[model samples]
Target: MRVKRYVVNALPEAVSMIRSELGKDAVILNTKEIRVGGFMGMFSKKKMEVIAAIESNQANTPAQPQRKASPQANEALEQILHTVQRTASAVMEPPIVTPAEKQTGRVEQEQSIIDEIRDLRQYMVKLSKQQGDHTALSEQLYELKEHLLEQEVEMQWVERLIQAIIDKQTEQKSEFTKEQIWQLAAEQLEDWLRPYGGIGISSAVRVVHFVGPTGVGKTTTIAKLAAEQTIKQGRKVGFITSDTYRIAAVDQLRTYANILNVPLEVVFSPMDLPRAFKQLEERELIYMDTAGRNFRSELHVSEVNSLLHTSEDSETVLVLSLTGKTKDMAAVADHFSKYGVRKVLFTKLDETSVYGAIFNLIMNFEMYPTYLASGQTVPDDIDRFQIETYIQHLLGSSSR
Candidate 1:
C-alpha cells in the first residue's frame, strides 16, 4: 500500500489533492480535526488531517477510462473496498493444517475456526457496509439512499445502509422494488439500533432529573410524565423546578401540578435540593426540572451535575429536540455524557419530518432513549422508545 497524509482546511480540498496526486484508486483511511502552527496554545488553525492509501499494483497500473462517477468518490470507494476485502479475507480464512497433523488437534482447530468465523462473518458484514462504495448502487438502493439523506441521516450511515441492501441484492440475485429496498434498510437499521432500545425511566427510581438546552420542552415533558404516573398508574408524583430563570416556568409547571393534584417545589440552587426533596418526600416519584442552560459548555453541565447530587436512587435524563441541529445536539450530548448522563428523551417529533437526528444521537453516544414526545398532549403523545415504531417514522410511508 502507498499511504500519504494531507492536512487541509476541509475534506473536499483533501479529496481534490488526493485524486490529482495519488490517482483515482486512493481511499481515505481516516480523517480527524487537528490544530497546527500556534504558539502558547493560542491562535491555532483548525484543519482536517486525512490519511489516504492505494494498492501498489493499482498505483503502477495505467489509467483506465473514467466512468460517470466523480474521481473523488471512485477513489474513496476503491480504498475502502480494498481495506474491507483484505480484512475480511484475513478473518474468514484460517491457517492451513498439514494432513499428517494430529487428528484430535485438527478437529479442535477446525471447530474453533468455525465458531469464530460465524461471529466474525456478522461483524465483517457491518464492516463491509460501513466502508463500501455508494456511487454505483442500484436504482432502488439509490432511491433509498436519497430518501435517507433527505431525512438528514449522516452520510457514513447512509453509505452503510445502502451497502447492506446492495449486499442482500447481490446474494439473492433478484430485482427489488422501492418498497423491498426500504424493508431491507429498515431491517438493517433495527439490527443496528436493537441494543439501545427498550429502556426508559425506571419505576423503582425515586427521582428523575430532566436536563437540556433551553426551549426543548423539558418543562412540558416533565408535566407529561408526572401526569402519566399520577393519573394512569395511581403513583403519587411531585415536581421540582430550578428553572426560576425562565419567566412563567414555575406557573406552567404549577398548572400541571394542580391538574394532577401533585405537590410542587421550587429550588433556586443546589443547596436547596435537600429542603425540596424533603417537601416531596411523601410522593412516590419526583421529576425535577432543571434550568436549561447552554449545556454544550462543560461548565454548565457540571453545574447541573452538582444539583443532581443525592443519596436516593436517581437517574438524569437528557432532553433533546428533533428541531435542533444534529451537530449542536451532539455537542450538548457529548458534554452531558462526560458527566455520566446515559439516558435521553427526545421531544418535538411532530414538528419535524426529519427524524435522523434521534438515530444519530442514540447511535453516536450509546445513550439509551427513554421516550419520544411528538405533540403537546400530556402523556398521550409521549411513548416509550420502540424500535419498530421509530423505524416506521424514520422510513416514512413510501419508499419512493
Candidate 2:
C-alpha cells in the first residue's frame, strides 16, 4: 500500500496532487480541515489536508501482454484477474511455434494482448463501480456525522461514530442507505454508552444523592425512583434532604415521604448528614436530595461534595435536564463530577426536540444516564435507560 498526506489551500488542489502523484488508481482515505501559518493564535490560515492511498498491482507478470496502461489495480481487481487467468489456463493448452511460423507467433502475441486488455477493461469498469460505491458511502458517513452532531453529540464522539460506521459499511458489499447508516450508528451508540441501565443499584446502594442545577425536576425524579423501589420493587427506600436552603423543597419531599410511608430527613449542614444517615441506615435504599446548586459557584459544588462525602459508601446521580443547553449540562456535570458521580439521570425528555446533550454528557464524562424522567408522574414517568429509545431519539424517530 502507498499512503500520502497532502496539505493544500483547497480540496481541489489536494485532489489534483493525489491524482498526479498516485495516478487514477489512488483513493482518498480521509480528509480533515487544518490551520496553518498562525502567530500566537492570531490570523491563522485555514487549509485542507487529505490522505490518499493506492495498492500495487498484484497480478502483473513479465510474460503478460503489453498495454499503454496496466490493469486498473486494487485488491478487487487483483482477485478478478486471478480468477480469469486460472480459468483460461485450465481450459486450454499452449501450442509450439516453428521458425517458419514466427509471423503467426507475432499474431498470437498481439491477440493475447487484445484478450488481456479486454479482461483488464472489465476490471477497470469494476474498479470504477467500487470507487463510486465508496464515494456514496462516504457521503452517507458525512450525513450520519451531521445527524449526530445536530443532536448535540460532541465532536470527538461524532468522529468516532463515523469511523465505526465506515468499518461496518466496508464489511458489506451492499449499498449503504440512510436506514443502514442509522442501524450501524445506533449499534455504535449503544456500544460506547456502556454500563447503562437502572441506576446500577438497588438495596445495595446505601446512600445516593440526586444533584443538579435548579429546575431540572430533581426532586420529582427522586420521588419517582423512591416510589418504584418501595411500592413496585418492594425495597425499603428513604429520603434525606440537604435542600433546607429552599423551604418549599423540604416540604415537597416531605409530602412525597408521607404519601409513600417513608422517612425524609432534612439536613441543615454536612454535620447533620451523619445523624440523618443514622436515622435512615435501617432502610435498604437511602436517596439524598441535595440542594440544586449554581454551577457557576465552585463553593456550592464543594459544599455538596462535603455533604455527600460523609458516607464513604455512596453514589451520586448527576441529574441533568434534557431541555437545557448542552453547554450548561456539560459544565454542570463537570462541576459536580468532583463529588464522584457514578451515573447520570436525564429529566424532561418530553420537553426538548434536541437530545444530543444527553449523548454529549455521556461521552464527554464517560458516564451513562441510568434513567430518564419524561414527565411529572411518580414511577410511571421514570424509565430505565433503554438503548432503543435513545437510538430512536438520535435517529429522530422518537420524541426528542
Candidate 3:
C-alpha cells in the first residue's frame, strides 16, 4: 500500500484528486480540517488535509495466479479506461456558457422543487402558530387528515386531498367554520366524482360485459342490472354468457335468466359472440357474463381478451371485491384494463369497512365505477355509484 496526503480547499476536492490519481479503489485513511495561507490567524483560509491509500491488486488476490492478458487486450482495456476517464472529467466540469445566469437559474429551479417537497411534508405535520398566519386553517386541515387516516385512507391520497384544500383556501378567503369545512370537503368529492361518473340507463350503450376475479359476484351483479332495466324501466334486455368453465355457473345464470324471462345465449368461443349478438339484435341492452379467471395469469387474461373483442358496442365493467388488498385489486384492474374496461363494479361492500380503495382506484385508473353490490340479494343488493353514498360508507355514517 502507498499513502499520500492532499491539502485542498474542501473535502470533495481532496476526494476528486485522490480518485483521479489512484482511482476509486483508493481508501480514505484519515482527514483533518486545517488552516493555510495566513501570516496571522485573522487572514487564514480553511482547508482539508486527507491521507489516502490503495493496495496493489496482486496483494488482494494473492491466492490466485494473475492471468496474463494478450497485448491486444491490454491495449484495448487501456484505451477504454482513458476514454472513460476523459468522459467523467468532461462531465465534472460545466461548459463555458453564460455561467452565472445558468447557475442562478439552476439554483432557483432546485429551490422551487425543495419548496414543493417542504409543502408536501407540511401536509403531514401539523403546523404551529409560530410557523405562519394560517394557524386556524392549519388546525382544521390537520384534523381532517387525522380523520381520513383513522378511516384507513392511504397517506398519499390524504396528502392530495389536503393539498387541494390548501389550494382552494388560498383562492377563497372566507371565515372558516366547522360546517364550512365539512361542506367544502363534500363539495370537493363532487369534483372528484364528475365527468363519466354518473350512473344511469341509456339506449346508446348496447353490450355491457362484466369481468373480474373469481367469486366477486359478477353474475349476480349482472342479474341485478338486468332486472332493474327489464322489470322497472320496461326496456328489452338480453343475456349472454361465455362462462362455460363450470356447469354450475352456467346453471346459476340460467336460473336468473328464467326468472327474468329473457333469452340467454351461451357462447363457447369468440366466433360465437357475433352469432349471439345476432340472436339478440333487437334487444336494447345485452349483458354478457364472463367466466371468473385468475387475473394474474397472462394466458387467462389473453383468453378473456380474445372472447371480449370489446368494440364500441361493448362496455366492459371490471368487478372487484372491496375485501381485497389495494395492491391486488390494482393489479387485477391493470391486468384487465388492456381489454377496454371502461367502468368498474365493486362487490361485497358489506364485507369491509374501509372504502379508500374505491377512491384510489378511481384516481389511479381514471376509470369511474358504475355500481356497488353490498349483499347476496339480486336486484336488491346493488346500488348505483354515488360519491355521497361512498363518502357516507367511508366515514361510517348512515345515509340521510
Candidate 4:
C-alpha cells in the first residue's frame, strides 16, 4: 500500500488532490486540523490534513538492471531528482514509484504502453463522473443496501394463500372489483379478531368507559372521544365520572364537560352509578371516566371492579401508555383483563421513540387498539385506529 498525506484549507480540495494523484481506489485513513508551529501557532491558521493510502500493483516487482544513461535520459533523471528534493524539503517524505521489471530498449513498445495508460486514465475519469460519492449519495446507498437485506421473511403458508387467490381469479376469468377486494380484506381482518368477537356500532345508547392504571391519560382520552362524537359527528354525548375517589379526577372530567357543554355526573359508588346512567339514558353515546389506580394494588382493583360490575351492558376499554416497557404493559394488560376489557386505547404515542412494545402487547394479549392518542392536545391529537397508518408511522415512513 502507498500512503500519502496532503494539507489544504478545505476538505474538498484535499479529497480532490488524493483522487487526482492516487485515483478512486485510495482509502482515506484519517483527517484532522492542526497548527503548523508550536509557540507561533497563535498566529498560524489551522490547516486541514488528510492521510490516504492506495494499493500499488508494481510494488512487489523485482528490480531491473540499470541501463547506460543517454544524454536525454540524464536530463529527465535530473528533472525528476529536482522535483523529489523540493517535495522532501516541504514534507516528511517524497512520493516513490517502483522501477520497471524489464529495461526494454524498444522505443515503439514504450510509446504503445504510454498510449494504453492514457486510455485507461480516460476510462477511470468516465467512471468517476458516472458515480460520485458525496455524503448524501453514500447515505442513500447505505439505506438501500440495508432495506434490501433487512426485509422480513413471511411464512410459506401466507405465500401459498396469495398464490391461491391469484389462481382462483385467473381460473374464473374475472378481475377483483373494489367491493370484492374490500370484502376479502374485511374477512381476513375479522378472522384475526375472531377471539375478541364481532364489533358492532351500539344502537341502544350504550356507554363506553375508559379504565386503566395511573398516568395512562384516561380523562384526556374520554374528553377526546366526547368532543369527536358530539362536536364533529353531532351525536348526543354525555359524560359520567366514577372517578370520585380523587377530587382532582372529578374536577378534570368537569372541566372537559364545561368546555364541551355536556352533562357530567359523578358516581361515588356502585349504587350511585345506576343513577348516573339514568341521567344520560336518552343520549346517543355516553363516556365514563374512571379513576386512574395502580393495578398491583388489590384494593384499587376491587374498587374498580365494583364500579364496572354495576353496569353489565357498558363496554369497558383499557387505556395503556405506549411509553411503557413491553413486560410492564403485558402485566398491566393482564391485571386489567379482570375488569372485562373489551378494547384497548393506547396513549402517549408521540412521547415514545420505540413502538415495538405496541406490537408486542397487541400480539401477545390478542387485543386490537380502538384508538390512538398521540399528543396532549384536546380533540385534535387523537386518531381512529388504522393498522396500515400506524405500521407505516412506526416504521419511519416520512409520508405518514
Taken over the whole model, the C-alpha lDDT of each candidate is 0.81, 0.73, 0.72, 0.63
Identify the runs in model 1 with alpha carbons over 4 angstroms from their true place. 1-135
- Per residue, candidate 1 scores C-alpha lDDT tens digits across 62-105 of 44333256677557655644444344344335467677764557
Q: Candidate 4: which pairs clash? A: none
Clashes of 3: 0
lDDT of 4 by residue, 1-400 (tens): 8999998775557656876787655655655566675465567766767787777872334322223335774475345434433332333222343345234433444455445434544444454433443221223333422332232212232333334444655788865553453344334433444554333224453777778888888999889888888888998888888776676988888888999999988887778877887888888788888888877665776678777764435677888887765666777777766655647888998887665555545555666677878887889998877765554444444212
Where does model 3 exceed 4 Å of error? Answer: 1-140, 150-152, 167-178, 199-202, 310-312, 396-400
Better of 1 and 2 by TM-score: 1
What TM-score should be assigned to candidate 4? 0.50
In order, how many clashes per candidate? Answer: 0, 1, 0, 0
Cα shift from native, residue 144, model 2 (Å): 2.4
Worst 10 residues of 2 by lDDT: 58-67
lDDT of 2 by residue, 60-170 (tens): 212222223234544555565455444334224345667767665757764675576456545654665455434444556667777777887788888777777767656
Q: Looking at model 1, which ten-residue stretch has the lowest summed lDDT?
A: 124-133
Model 4 residue 148 CA deviation in Å: 16
* TM-score, prediction 2: 0.63
lDDT order of candidates, best first? 1, 2, 3, 4
Best-performing candidate as measured by TM-score = 1
lDDT of candidate model 3 versus the reference? 0.72
